[model samples]
Target: MREFSEAYLERTREGMWDDSRQALAPLALDSRERVLDVGCGTGELSRVLVAESAGEVVGCDADRELLEFAGEHVPVIAGDALRLPFPDDSFDLVVCQALLINLPDPAAALAEFARVSTDLVAAVEPDNGAVEVDSSVPTEERLESRARRAYLEGIGTDVTLGADAREAFSEAGLDVLETRRYDHERTIEPPYGEAALTIAQRKATGAGLADDRETMLEGAMDDEEYDALRSEWRAMGRDVIEQMEDRRYRRSEEIPFFVTVGRVNGPQ
Candidate 1:
């Protein structure tokens, strides 16, 4: 599994559920008795689960450090996704957000979730391949799409597992219920905040691309190709900063997420 910094998770997941939570309807949270959020890093979704469900929401993660932050919101425990700490039928609903995409064997993890959940299993995953970016900087969109393709090709796990998660549910012996699409859009415009400024800085320095250098190289992209891409990325970043300074920069990234819900033990 890929490990992520709390800051990274926070930045990526910011305002994810703020837009519209209608996609979460299939989980039927209001009547849930017990809910377990696996890979509940920093408790972003865990807090939402707590808010939507009257039942107790427990967070479980393999990262002890992350668990510390999550523990602040709801009950947390250090546990692996493939091997949960609780026994069978421990939770009425078992769910994960952006977790399955990082796992090499998502079906195996779903199987484990099925073991613990007597009722439903759900996953909120993004289709990174389908990410759409619109930016005021002319080259920014092209460069971002280029970089994203390489990263997706190089990444070991299925980062684009979005709506196709139904296959995994079947493999885990769960009956497919429904899948809902949720568009999580992040935008940057005038009055740039600290986070936005920091991200722009990273772009100017090519630090963002540098972070994924190894992964991009693992794909069909060679060193020379990566170097050229990074150069263009940095140049685009400078343009973004200039536009921001003039209060003319505007960017929006729309990531499509699929909320796949499945039922265990067929129907009651």
Candidate 2:
């Protein structure tokens, strides 16, 4: 069970929030409906729902750091996705983003989501089936990708949550209503320039790439070397961005954002 630290959540805020809001648009939620955002990282999605639903959203997660950030926007509580804190049929809609793949038992989590919601249970997850590896990408960029893959493999969780989510929703007796794919392309800017670098650093640290922090620090190059490395890395990043923008990457499969809706069948 990997816990997201405050620093990591803050660093990835824009990307996470932006994707979540976009995913919710097609849901066509009523302004007055109550919603639950499960495994709501930093509660950004929950915040969007709260604003749109007029403060009728509640978010829950096991990470205290994320919940603390979430508290500023909506009612956030520390709880596990596998076991929700609410009673059955407590929400009109239950949504989860970027969460299913990370869970040890996604089936149980889906069952919980189904139990809590009365009208809908929607989820947005990355489709690894859509992962496009550009051969022209630089060595450092490729290194970063490899590191992420290795890290997810080490954690024994799926890197992409899309496939598993669809199956889980079905197993939980939710009707799959609408599914859409978004090939979101954006130019990541500076200050946030080295997303790949940051990812690599985190994975390295988490995986104990070296014996200890001191040893790891010693192995990592100084600012000068890192800057030089970025020159090449940026070129690769640019190539990837161009491909994504032009839809050039091979579409391995339909990477969909699963939006499901169903009426509660059993007694509350």
lDDT digits (tens) for residues 180-229 of candidate 1: 99999999988999889999999999999999999998999999999999
Residue-level lDDT tens digits of model 2 in 119-147 = 67777777653554434334533644543
Which run of 10 residues does model 2 get worst, by summed lDDT?
208-217
Off by over 4 Å in 1: 266-268
Give per-model CA RMSD. 1.5, 8.2
- Where model 2 places Cα greater than 4 Å from the true spot, the runs are 15-22, 132-137, 190-268
Name the best candidate (by TM-score). Answer: 1
Cα displacement (angstroms), candidate 1, residue 260, comes to 0.5
lDDT score at residue 221, model 2, on the 0-100 scale? 49
TM-score of each: 0.98, 0.68
